[model samples]
Target: MSNQWQPHAAELAEGLSLIELSDGLGHLDLGDSEDVMVMGVCDDSRHAMPGYAMLCLPRSEGKATQFAESAKEQGAIAIISVGVSVDTDLPHLHLESIAEAGLLLRRMFKTEQASTHFYGITGTDGKTSVAWMLREALARYQSAPIWSSGTLGWMRSSNNICDIGNTTPSLLTMHAMLNAACQEGVHAVVSEISSHGIAQGRIAGLNFKTAIWTNMGHDHLQDHGGYEPYLATKAGFISDCAAHGGSVVANADHADIRERAPESTNWYGHGLDRDDVNLGWEQELPGLLRLSCAGEEVVIEDIPIGDFHAENVACVALTLMVSMGIELQALPELLTGITAPPGRMQDVAAGYGQVFIDYAHTPEALERCLKAARKLVRNRLIVVFGCGGERDREKRPQMGGIAAEFADAVWITSDNPRGELPAVIASEIEAGMAQPYRVELHLQLDREQAIAEAVEVLAEGDILVIAGKGHEAYMEVCGRRMPWSDAEVAERYLHRKHPGSGFDGERLCA
Candidate 1:
């Protein structure tokens, strides 16, 4: 038989028996059932299996109850819970931590694999972009098939994509995706390595071929507990990759990355340090940067706006060169057709001022994006943005400070107010801005109205940045998601005035 299902699937098929388990006694009653094996334990609800188990306490609100109810309804046979002591009549497994469950599964499903090539990218911000570049380049170098599993989605092709519920899927799911790719003859698999993923050992069993670091900055302090711990988590990627016989592709431009550079024989550098790096870019336009790496140079081929992305592109190029052995000479020619990843720094042209949509939630990214937008604005830089609910609220003020310093005017609006009041979140942001900026601040809770106001106030040379949402199609408000698109609203406003003069159909506008 092909290595497809191998011995694990056979074992899973045969040993698929229902087991009732509980850690702490009496108070919690776990319902028992037959024919249900809770697929290892995981805290991430996105990776929870319907027929498996779920640990719900770590989440903010009713995540556990909601997930349990949903999973049971979807045919989940068992639940591994942490918080509620009273377990339902459903088959259940309770453990101190989900990690314990994961350990059990690994031991039970011991299937050995010969080879697996994982490309891991970690950074404070640009992890997704570097991963994307590496994925694209691998597809070019190896005529063999490839697939990408990240926050954006699983890209079977440039055109064919699937939703990725998590930035980093659980170990079991990661292996499953890789197994699927291998079954399909995939030669390369690029995955985004979040700090949490590295810290949690989600990518443990997988062997990596290359590790890329876009840059390091402040983020995930709440999860990591502090900045030092967060930095350590990011550092683990390079260390782990080296141990796995994979090369490190690091950005020499970043101070933190440079200081914590890992030891690797196949190390390649990328950034503004052209004196000792493999990749660098020349500023071509206000927001466009011409890329040059190895022996090739690709003119600004409609880059995803913002200056920070230039570094991201370089990191991707260098990773491709080191991992797949692709020459830089081929980049310029190949990049001629490449476009910006969905919402990294996508520019949407409006009739009056140009609108740029980006996924800049962090303070560093917000600062970089605002500065980049400022550079391109001849008249004024208008910003419409907000902070997400149930996230790192500490950065709210920092984000406001960055916008105040760069954007000529800003309209603070709601962005994924998951469970928090939009007005409350907006107020937190407003409190961070300087008093002088208050005059320029517009409080328009309706994102569409904010975009409309920005467009209406925009002149010919002005630039409008509609940020925080980026490529997402829905707006999460008060525990529910509403179908909304900043790009759509901007385009509608544009079309209402100029019919075909927007970036709606064209990749880039003149």
Candidate 2:
């Protein structure tokens, strides 16, 4: 039996013709004929199979022509490129741009236009939280399955979750996932749209029914070259949503988002202090989050403990209000059961002091996580964190400064030092702090040892926060991925330090 998967014959028959695909290409020569059937389309030539149409896009890795020979060897029936000719028997279709061809291919494969309502959430911090919350809320009311794709992974319904590597997968993979969801009768699809994904045209062809904007911050500066470009890339999603006759839920607290938000569409703003917003949240005592919208208020008692979570909840509430049209009065009861996503402010019992594992790599994220930790710590707050190599290096010193300002003690360690030396990365982070820092600092190159030291020094009523590499199952070191988990390592160290602490590797709810 062949290991290759094939698409439905009916779908192939209904696929767009070459003439229709090249309709927008001005006077470009589509060699031979335009009557050939496109059974499948792909950008990666390595994944090409018989009857597949390969897209030769010029990427940073190499030119698309570099892989055209391999694609032909694998039995590609057609090649789409921008005036690049390959010595193969396959039909060559020329276009002005490769991205245009990708968008056309995405439209061809996306057959779930009618059954699914797409919601796109884009921002620096709360994309995953908002997407997960929306999925959970919609699942309660809708009969069909709810699919969420983002940092955590692609999830079908509540129990089925799988990773697709990138937060936003390639257009080809996205269309395949959407088609599968359509086959499974999905009613809603929520996705976290990253700036890189938007700028790189990963989500080019899909139209969303609702678009959400979390707060903007300093992130992906290296990829975007600057903050303004990154903000523009995210803002473009809202414009696309508006163009499709969809509504937008924007964060009123962010001036950039408020300014870029579509004024003509059904725009709903959300924030803690903005009176113009449709939804807002105010923190209350005894672990209650009071949510208000349109003269109606709902107080949720089972609120997750975190300052950042309040803002995330407000975003989720606003998104749900716009997407599902659920009454604010009913949200209090519906929201009490929702939980935070894994590796995001996840708490574990460590004798008397609590241990938190979070994927907070950015300076702002670290500051917010420590602030939330400060509120919960009874005695002291100790943080163990590190900056990743080959990322935004400018944030290294900033993170170190935030750690010094917030944490009682800091342990700077390696965080996926992909190509750089671990000690060098640690030193860069240390450079951000004041001379003889206000708090005690420990530099450990080995992450596991750093975690062990933090756990061993934990006193009763103190809190230990393990930041960065939250839900990741492996650590990248020198181009190789090794099995590692911050939560598991922390738990093992905690058990070793205090035997019979009843730490069963389970997260403790706040």
Candidate 3:
């Protein structure tokens, strides 16, 4: 493999020579005066490699300095910790905050900043879809490569994508990806910024040229303490982008986002048939979504998708035209062949009505997916979904209630019950259903069996939706992530039912 992604120590310590990061008088022993070269930065000692700089952060468990010995044994050359001292041969640098130091370290190690326009999309539901659509739209108007980083990973191109393990990666990893993109002559980078990313300083120190707020919902409530803090965290991205002389494109359909939008910079809003929005969409036909932006109309045909997708498309168009300078007239042609991100309403197979696999884990997202699936199904709509373990437990009941309200038949199953009992998680979800004892509500602990049963019971005109683990390839149970795929399971069952029919997976149309 190429070493182009690695950042040298001298490059990483560019502005650290005379900087005073904290108010302390250098109380602790700052290690021996040996010059060190760092090949990488690691937060976790388990992932520490030779010549890496270990960033010791304070966690709920303990101080990160507790793992310094392990990282040193793994060949860490230097240590940067907050409020802790490690006695080792490695050089130690103390800072009041490890997150701040990490952000600064990112700035130092990153290659010459790319002129590439950076757009950040943050919200509860449509971050991935809007970012993916922005990447697709940018690819059509520019010759330089467009990079996208989010749940789908660091996408160098549509065909070449790699996972970085988070919706927004660590500050160091984010800079590394951006540096690599700049080195490869990428023109723009669009990333899905999450609330956790914003609150945790994962996206700190980077300047976004434009920020898009898709829509905020009641997800991640546990992480942010409540809905107010969650919304505030999402708003921080918009504030930072505007402070950097950038603009914001907001979803006017969301009242909270519209109210909290920044007044300092130019704000462009988009929504569904709203008079105040800069871009508005009206569904002219069953499968066609017509958008009117700046008196120019673009007709999206044959994609009898959800209103959420049309809203996502409208957000993309407004962001490109208002923030990125793409002409409004070019939207229709550019958006013609664009498809949703992998598993975001991804139609993996057809034949018996259709089967859609989406990453709709939140109550709002699940409701949207089922409502969209309802429009496409001529008969009954069956949904298979489950809440993730150790996440926002409050959303479990809400998701279950949405499934109960929307789908004709609801299948509650396991979804990455990491370190938590699958049955316990399913019970929590079942608690939200108004009619938990209804005959149509099927509770299956085994996700694969649940999917198979769902497929088996689907009528000819029925639609089957497997929600909650869209593009994820692993199912985490009892802290171990085993290999699993919702789309693959659905396909296998569909093929077993219709043997030798040459049922190649194809996009279903209305």
On TM-score, the candidate that comes out on top is: 2
Q: Which ranges of candidate 1 are over 4 A from the true structure?
A: 1-111, 265-280, 284-302, 349-353, 499-510
lDDT of 1 by residue, 1-510 (tens): 222221111113223443333323212334444346554443444544455555443332445666666656655556656434423557665545444544444333442352557787778788767666666756666755577777776777666666656688655566556656655667778888888887876675676778877777767788888888888888877887787677988877667777777756333343334656656766656545566654656664655655677666666666666766667667665554455576776766533437788888889898888888877788888889999888888889888888888888899998988899889999999888988654388999888888888888878888888888787888887767888877778777776666655435333321
Off by over 4 Å in 3: 1-40, 44-52, 58-63, 82-89, 98-103, 110-113, 264-273, 302-304, 350-353, 436-439, 504-510
List candidate 2 stretches off by more than 4 Å.
1-34, 60-62, 82-89, 110-113, 264-274, 350-353, 504-510
Can you rank all candidates by TM-score, best first? 2, 3, 1
How many collisions per candidate? 1, 0, 0
Local distance difference test, each candidate: 0.67, 0.76, 0.75
Measured with C-alpha atoms, the lDDT of residue 441 in candidate 1 is 83
Per-residue lDDT of model 2, residues 251-363, tens digit only: 77778887898885333343345567677778755257888776777887766667677777777776777777788888876777677787888875544548889888888
| RMSD each, Å | 6.7, 3.6, 4.1
TM-score for each predicted model, relative to the true structure: 0.77, 0.90, 0.88
Query: Worst lDDT window (10 residues) for model 2?
Result: 1-10
For candidate 3, give the lDDT.
Answer: 0.75
lDDT of model number 2 = 0.76
